[model samples]
Target: MERTGTMKTSKKMMHCFLWVLALSLIPSAFNGCGGGGGGGTSDAPKQSNNSEITVSSNQINFGSLVANQTADNSFTIQNTGTRNLVIGQISTSGAPFEIVAGSDHCSNRTLLPNQSGTIIVRFTPTANAVYTGSFVIPSNDPDESSLTVNLSGVGQGLNVTINRVDSSVPGNIRMIVSVTDANGDAVANLPNTAFTVFEEGEHKPTIVVSNADVHPVSAVLALDNSGSFWASRLEVQNSAKTFLDQLRNSDEVAVIKFAQVIQLAADFTQLTSAAEINNLKAAIDAPYTDSINATLLFDAVYNSVDRLILRNPNNRLAIIVVTDGQDYDASTLLPGSTHTLDEVIAHAQQAGVFIFTIGLGADMHTAVARRMANETGGEYLYPPTPAGLNAIYTKISQILINQYEITFNTTKLVGTLNNLHVIVDDGTMQGDDAISVTY
Candidate 1:
């Protein structure tokens, strides 16, 4: 009996041990089955080494150097990666700036993990300038496909910015310009002796710098009061008043309101007078009350330019035409303007008038208006809504008010394309501008 009992106990102990061992081996078998053998998607990330790029600085100032006098500067690029980084071409823009060949170790080279390279730059300029430009760095960095580094350098002082070029008169070419020094400050109080003018590369002997910043301006304001502006009337009038208040005392401004018929709301007058400004506001605020629903945009622009020409041709003339849509007067049921778009542009060009156009909404005839502005040396602005017209008017007024007009006598034949180059020397520092105009 004792032997049988001991045999039963041994059998039970062996069975229990086998069952526990099998349970432990079951997990190992499941683990052994997962060795990247699936054809489906895996949620794990790639284990490949990724190349990274880090720059020491994004800006390089080469300081001031002489004209054609070359200076050297450099920036460092480091690779914070686990793999090799291959860099591509490095390109730069703006004049007198270039990359020094055989000296750039960062471009067209392989940078190993934790390695650094250098980008060498050369500033060999032709004229004195306060130059600002940038260069692009392309690499095999996963996070950064490319990077732009800003670069600035100064060469002596002369860098001319041409504000605009105009044909103010039949025999004269007018130029508006401003000069900046090496420090980028406007150099003021320059004289006629400070400027040298050239037409078609031939030096002109008669260069008179007249119409200083305080010079008077003659401008006409053309506001759209058509069917398109029915919803925007109050906003339009408010913006027009804002423009009227900003003009200088010497500006001869006219207010022209046009719907189906163009009306000279207020004739040419100076905004410097309180009564003149009030008159312009009142004219702008007057009700149309007519059932005519058409826009004579082209005619308004044409008549405004004509009014400016009739006022005084010597002063700077500009026409600010604000509209929301195309001209619909020709097809209207009411009497309207008869001038064409091409004729208006031609007249403005011949009169040397700048037509600054403001397109109010998305449906505005901006393409045609832009052409009028571009051909007449004016600007076209599209304010998303009418409320933003104040800022645009402020910009236009400032530009027209504080301009220095330099008139040069040119013997070039009419309708000939003439390229004019001007260099204005502010005694010590100088700047230059290049312009092409058919006169």
Candidate 2:
């Protein structure tokens, strides 16, 4: 009987231990289908399950972009799972650079498992400001609910300016060129730096460029309308036209015509059109019928120089006088309105106005004309006949081509008359370095 009772108890104990083992195994089986494995969770992101998409680069970077220029870049999105991955939203940080629309920005786009599509990116910069931003892509997958793209860029500024200099000693005009880089800093070691001067539509030669600081220039053209000059007016007209043709687009030109009353044919206008200059030449050649008895030569010179005093307070001034050189009667200038011939010479010297005199004949007050020319640091030329006038015109044209303007900083001037000397360093001129210092 006792042995039978022992057997029953043993069986009951075995059953109890078996029940505990089964409970532990049940938990292990549930864990295998629950959250322990890579793809166990129902909402877990998985490339193999087609629930997640992969981007080649989470951030796009554009190093540097220049002002008024553009730059571009792109990336790709791939699906590595069996399910479709849909990107529901894309957001970007709104500072610095901007987000330009790309193919991925299109609505309702989906990537199939094991297939790939593109997410193009673009950055546009405005002004010279530095910028940085990011783009975020949100999706249904829990692992990659948000994909962030980083961006950065910079803009460089540009610079521009106009520089003028005085090549004129007493009262002349000259310009300087000093172009700057994008940073407003002057470019170093620039080649072929030059400034052009113009009046109306006429082109003057390039002004000699030395330093970009202050350039020096002194120039003037005086015209003769004396009765004797009338005979060669056509030649004079041609000479004037040729001279105007050689003018640079930036230089200043003053036209003077003298007989009794000195007339300013033109003043300080840019030469932009040939027609305008031709019109001026026609007007200059128009007939003047008064008797040859009144050539107020000294008065004209004085007037031209005096006018320059107002035009430029500190630049060296020059006068080109076209005349017959006959001091027939003179003295038409009102008292206090002008100076005597000697006084005009002295004033020109004091003011540093160089006078270049063109005489119509050696028979018509040649001595006086030559003297005036010499006193004012100028030359006197006699044309004699109409054909001679044309030759004279050619010679004068050559001289004008050789002319340049010097501009000095007014801050360097004492406002008193100062001596000016020009030295050209062109080695090709052989031994002829002695430049005629006009003014």
Candidate 3:
């Protein structure tokens, strides 16, 4: 029994010795493979001489950003070496562009041995400005100490819009404006109150007031083409040709003819050459036979005021109305109808559209001509004979070249005489001052 007990003790001791040796080998293997000490908790990291870490994309690509647009990007890092890594101080270095959210914007983050993590970068631009920056990524691993990432983008343009409205009662001038930029966006901080209103060919009017934002020129030409004037059509054409010949090429002129119903000889067009002017006149003179309908004479006048004069706020505006005689259909949109002629006339006047009237002989409505001219500080003419057309045209040409533009900040008033005060010559109305108000 004593011998058996001794043998058992020896075997147990041998087993214990083998277990200790095995445990020692396990730690050695772990230390060699992991490089860092194999202890579960080791504050001091083990250093490896033969290991390295590298970042695949050192640059973050953010492509094609527009104004008010945002963008994002990311890159990966790899540990090809036998050591652990702790990334420290990842930062962006550009203006206007800021880091919104992501790991890329972090400072001092840990990365395990032979392990990799992705860093995200984000950008948001405030204005129309281009930007570029880099992320300075610092790491504990000497081989991959610092990783540089590039970021870039562009700024966009401002958007603007312009809208105009006309409100004239019994022949007064009224207008309002709204503006935006090229991107179809409203421009907030614009100095629109300093905007100035000027007529084409005219010096800025002497009406010393506020608002100086400059605008384009607006104009409408209402032509008369009727059977009653068929014999004198050529003469009327000559006068029209002469009048148009003197107009600036920038003028947007529309020609309307009325007999049976109102028709457009031509929509708005710019007069470039004498040939174009002659062509316009010839178009007016072309032979046509349509029984004159009860004329919506005032309706045509009002429509011109609404469509042409009150559409674009960036220009000087005016209307020239031509007619020959009585309305066959007098039961149209006059004072007692859907839209009163007086209202239309008042709107045109208030919108700052100068009104000119051309009457053919005694057969024309003298009252309408007189009312339109008187309301807008314009002139009314009666060409009795066909040959008188050229003379009338000459006068019109002179008037076009001699008129001046005067914008006054009249106390916003109501009713017909709101803007009807006489534009007195303040010694400021000279040859240079006498500019074409109706382009």
Candidate 4:
């Protein structure tokens, strides 16, 4: 009985030893087969190193812009990882917002580790309203493959002004119109079918001439450099240069600065090159005396038209005058004052010149300016502040560049003071003008 019990105890001890050995080998088996327990083994799972994309901004606000004006902004994309970032696709939402071509650095390109790229965005609103859109970019970023940039803008209203109407030939009348939306913003692409005409207080079938058919413009800039305008002299000169910059290569411009007497700064010259425009700017920047502190408004107007009428007789002629005060010389205060208001008007009529007048301050003689513009079939403007000078000049330049010539048979109304009226219908908007035509 004792020998059998001893044999059973031996057998149980052997079984316990085998179980302990198997438990000890389990950790070694797991470590040899690429498990988490291994720290310095070649078969361990590798850590991931992925490329990431980060943007400079996610939103862009364009503030406020005039209709048809263009504005731009830029954003940056950085690759913040250990691998190269591949850009796949780039696109915009729709109109008024676009990715400017040649300005994107990430299109179908690879950005190495820690490298950055740029994307330029442009906004051009066609009408008055608030607009919203987005720009999308797809890349090989591990976390974020698709990115978006939000865009917003506001467009303001546009104001149109008819400056003048004149007839060089017997049966045709030329109308000068100015269109602007905001400071330094001019409206464009106005169609020809937007005009109508009435002759002798009767509706006349009018023919509209496209801007391409009109001849090049001949314009004279009449500036008032009196003591009252001293505060805005530099700005005035700069604004006049802006006006010259807006003219076409085929257009001719002359400069006339007046205080008590009219001084010709530049003769009629084509603005074909930068040198010519700079020469005119330099002439405008020349020195002048304030000793004769009188406003020779009428004399200046008459002389400016006289200078333009002879140069481009067949081309469209115009005189733009800027003044801060009334015609002090109209009272005959200065010695040897040559021209009167009536004589100036008659000369303008005979030469078929349109006159545009701009009044600066409350002391401006609005009545006289209005009379001159009205009698010559031109328009008068009174800007609220000096900062608005550039915009007004830009509008005038656009007007000269985009005028319509309307023709009607006036042979039956010869020697008669006929009333002329015009209407311009542009889809949702309409404009009208009336004047007296004497043959």
C-alpha TM-score for every candidate: 0.54, 0.42, 0.43, 0.57
Candidate 1, 206: how far from true, in Å?
A: 7.6
Which regions in candidate 1 have their CA more than 4 angstroms from the true location? Answer: 1-173, 176-197, 203-211, 329-337, 409-417, 421-439
Better of 1 and 4 by TM-score: 4
Q: What is the TM-score ranking, best to worst?
A: 4, 1, 3, 2
lDDT: the better of candidates 2 and 3 = 2
The whole-model lDDT of each prediction reads 0.75, 0.55, 0.54, 0.74
TM-score of 1: 0.54
Of the two candidates 3 and 4, the one with more favorable lDDT, higher being better, is: 4
lDDT of 1 by residue, 175-206 (tens): 76655444323455567798888888899887
Model 4, residue 286: distance off in Å is 0.4
Put down candidate 4 lDDT per residue, 235-321, tens digits, no spaces: 888888899899898988898898877788988889899999999998889867544477777788888877877875667778888
Candidate ranking under lDDT, highest first, comes to 1, 4, 2, 3
**Candidate with the greatest TM-score versus the true structure:** 4
Considering only N, C-alpha and C atoms within 3 Å, which residue pairs clash in candidate 4? 163-379, 194-424
Which scores greater on TM-score, model 1 or model 2? 1
lDDT of 1 at 436: 70
Q: Write the residue-wise lDDT of candidate 2 on 34-140 in tens digits.
A: 75753336566543553776878866767544344445566677766567778766667874544456556422567677667665566666566677888777776
Better of 2 and 3 by TM-score: 3
